[model samples]
Target: MDTASSSSNSTMAEFDYLFKLLLIGDSGVGKSTLLLSFTSNTFEDLSPTIGLDYEKNCWGVVSDIIFLFLYHEAGQERFRTLTSSYYRGAQGIIMVYDVTRRETFTNLSDIWAKEIDLYSTNQDCIKMLVGNKVDKESERVVSKKEGIDFAREYGCLYLECSAKTRVNVEQCFEELVLKILDTPSLLAEGSAGVKKNIFKEIPPQSDASTSGCCSW
Candidate 1:
């Protein structure tokens, strides 16, 4: 498995708030595409990530300055072990799913949320649920209302974005940062104050089934 970093490292002195953010979702859910689009502001053909991809972004300034350290982990089951290792100390998480694939959207509740509860550092860590690939309307199997409903039910900030078209791509990250800042502890002492998570275990997935387009 191959892993890569996106840019040169910046010292902690370069900004005020440094938030470690994690990107996670099932394979082909456009996690990498969103990251590339957000950081570089352009869409490029991307190979499926093998292990992990890292990016650093700095936003705001002076009293409002914030630095985001993003980690994009491969969604393939084979890399789950490697990716889960990075979950500790994350101040924010972006859980992505493909709006075109109903299976990916369903797994957010059935699979990904369990992983979040299992490995995330803090149960209260700012979370954002992103439904990606909105540009593919013809192929979409998930609706915007479904996305919003899921977010409301699960208590996460939600957004639909089209990385290929750059729709809501920048705003996605901007909103997540705003949410992180809304939590008081995360902004207290820059890097030194990152909260050690007290995990709230998610109950085991039952044999229960939810019928949808992907059921076939």
Candidate 2:
């Protein structure tokens, strides 16, 4: 809920906890847009690329610093080899899907989770199922109840967000961070991997007016 210090600006921060999180899903889903939305709080018509995009953000108080290294991987098949490498030592993996694309939603367990299990150092990595571009309610092929049900069955946190509208973007990250903060076992489990955690519950936030861009 407080102003966050971006990775671009926090080169000298004295961080206590460092976590690596990956944004992964189908190629056309808004992983990069979500990253930009969180870090810069703006949206752009970002062209798809094959390389990994990194952003850092610092949260919590000065004494209990939490630094997150966010990696937005290109979802194209050509980048699969490269993106999988980024999964090493990841503490959190956000499996994103386009709400308007039924195929993308269906691929959550079949494609992304399987790939994550293959490369992720921590098998019990914090997982979140994010349905992006909920702003396109008219064209949405995936329903909120369906997303929640799938996430529940998959044992992952679930959220629907709109990166373009900046709705739930902050909450998405905050919820993941809170989950990490609360689970000590997960933090200690990172073992030589590029991840860690803290013990703090994510406080609930009041739902306010807010409003991702995705299509089938």
Candidate 3:
């Protein structure tokens, strides 16, 4: 990876509001581990977030909204209340789960559906799924095709990466920001039925899901 002090890093700095991006999945899915890498460029084992954890950051075009990591063990009622409110100004969401954990990936739909209901007004909110822990060749539970297929069914972007190895970890975040600013008309997916309004843009999300245990 190129150093942030490099010339390439300067080019990546151009953007408006910092988008509010969420790291979500079931308990022990490595959501917290990946968050460590993202916010501090480091990794460590941690406990489930008590209520909601926050990370504020700016990544092109989006003014950082509060990034909330809903603990894996958060009850549905609590999530519906606390996490739901943060969506009022959310720009995008990054839902992640361990690739070897099928239950985590399966619950992606449930979270998405809930968001749609909670933030009905924020239709422009972009969401993507990340399959974490690809570094573990053995004990792999979910496959790439399955992840891609789920992304399609939910109308979201999908990719897999390993936080431990730093494979596609940074790139996924970069692509997410790009997707936020990318006018759907320019994308092949835009040609079909759904088309994001070029005039209006999604605001950064302040709050942001999960079922399978997130353990890294």
Candidate 4:
């Protein structure tokens, strides 16, 4: 994986495809932390995202693809009106829940999933159920089986991740992007150019080692 510090026209030209992916769930499920971990490979206690926050990531495995990630504030009713617009043009959605919180898990199906179905323009949008904060295993109320069951019932992929520990953080996005790449309809909508000044450039590095449970 690679990251950019500048979204120059030359930098944007390197991408072969572009995709819009969203991170959503009840607030405090670590949506912002998960994104921070994935993009910068670091974690910190972040204040809740106001309105919406997004980051542009240029990733490559087989080919270069630029991802526009929209992080939504899901727990606040005040943000409801903005959600319809947020769901537009999304090719992938990461529905997140904190494993220690039961309500967050339940709301994935009861609330967030319904909104996605109602507002998403792409009927075939790939969704992933991510149980975040798996490092708090002792406090976890939502078991792995339950997450799998929900994913199966919801017709989406599932995984448990800890942003603080960096467990499966990279895998989460990689799998989502791979699925989008595999889908013919999504591939047909790929764009090569992105608006300038959206991302920063970082020198490429070898894959970072991920170890331990909660320690960063």
Candidate 5:
């Protein structure tokens, strides 16, 4: 993976972000895999996501940018409760889909609209659409144009990513962080909402060496 772009300076202000990001999609949309790549530098293709799972990431930034990571997963029924609980103070939310699974992608709104409403009502939460599993072009069921249009309709940024190849995954996160930075108040609000994680104290070099975790 390419090294993340963080400023040379060291301070909490440089690393702070005002957005809470949540990943929502169908069971097999590679949400967990993507989270693993960003947070722990691990990528494990897992079995179907059952109830719900979560992880967090912290990114270094330059200029006025701050990046924080939030990853969450849930089943069809668990969607309502899980999301309502997690996205309460999110800075941004990423709704993901598998490019090769139209059914999975199609039902995303049905399963997650409530959660979207929860965060959207707060005004601080920005959103983005992510199409996952882009490496499987031959099996692709959704067109890039279609995804972009949907995102635009919802007023969100859109990007297709392949976690397996590490393609555009980092870029997608970067875009979200930069978008949140564009609004400083959101960042200030997120800072108060976000609690520090124990894993963050771990060194970056140590995390890189621990890639590809998760038995799945």
Candidate 6:
């Protein structure tokens, strides 16, 4: 289980598949912090995103299967045009909200989810509802049950994690990626209708490592 830092000298060609994932929510919801924690295994106070941010990481889910993670943080209003463009090819969408802010949690359904349905081309894209900042238990305004209820109604997975403490940060991505891998339609190829069953014959290995990198 080797998890590489963002500075690791890894190349895209080394991976078997590439998956585009987007991180979205209201500004100041810790989307950037969550991303920083995931890619570098570190956390830092971050300002509200002015426009867009991108990061890449590789996860070794199976012995031979490598997943290239492309993450885009879309939180600014001015970048709506540019951000909407990213929604087209997304394979996984991580809808994040700050646990201390009820409004951010409400926007997940009232705002973000609607934008996703409007722009996402992939109907089968996996969605995960993330309630961030669980470490601030005292400051929490949103309950875990509220998050679970939203996830159920929104038809997505739900997880509450603290990017600051690194709790469930890696597990959050791992679960989403595993779900994507299990979805056959997501693995389908070109317009010619050719499909690849990459994992069908490969037995699950317990010793696979996780490696990835990130950039601002």
**Best TM-score goes to which candidate?**
4
Q: Which residue pairs collide, candidate 1?
A: 121-197
Runs with alpha carbons beyond 4 Å of true place in candidate 5: 1-15, 63-67, 78-80, 118-121, 192-216
Candidate 4: tens digits of C-alpha lDDT, residues 1-216: 544333333444565777778888888999888988887799999976666666546665554545454444546676445676677777899999999999999888889989988899998899999999999999999999999999999889888999999999989988888898899888777665433232221112211122211111
Question: Alpha-carbon error at 119 in model 6, in Å?
Answer: 0.3
Candidate 2: regions farther than 4 A off: 6-13, 61-63, 188-216
Candidate 4: lDDT of 175? 87
- Cα displacement (Å) at residue 97, model 4: 0.4
Candidate 5 accuracy as TM-score: 0.76
- On residues 27-115, what C-alpha lDDT tens digit does candidate 1 reach at each position? 88888778888776778768787765666666764355566667777788875555445677777888899988899989999988888
**Residue pairs that clash (backbone atoms under 3 angstroms), model 5:** 18-187, 19-91, 20-90, 20-91, 42-212
Q: Model 3 over residues 11-116: C-alpha lDDT tens digits?
A: 2123223344556667777777776666467777776655555543333223332112222223234443455444544556777888887777777777645655
* Cα lDDT tens digits for candidate 6, 1-216: 345333445444455566777888988888878878987889999877655556657655545344444455446676454555567666789999999999898888788999998888898999999999999999999999998998999899889999999999988888887787778776552111342332221223212123345322
Better of 4 and 5 by lDDT: 4
**Which prediction has more favorable lDDT, 2 or 5?**
2
Which lDDT values do the candidates have, in the order given?
Answer: 0.72, 0.73, 0.56, 0.75, 0.66, 0.72
Error of 4 at 24 (Å): 0.9
Query: What tens digits encode model 5's per-residue C-alpha lDDT throughout 90-163?
Result: 67789889999998777766656555875453575678899998889999989999898888777888899988
TM-score per candidate: 0.81, 0.81, 0.67, 0.84, 0.76, 0.82
Model 6 bad stretches (over 4 Å): 1-11, 189-216
- Name the 10 consecutive residues with the lowest summed lDDT in model 2: 207-216
Question: How much is the lDDT of residue 99 in candidate 3?
Answer: 84
- As for TM-score, the candidate ahead, 1 or 5, is 1
Best by lDDT: 4
Better of 2 and 6 by lDDT: 2
Cα-based lDDT at residue 208, candidate 4: 19
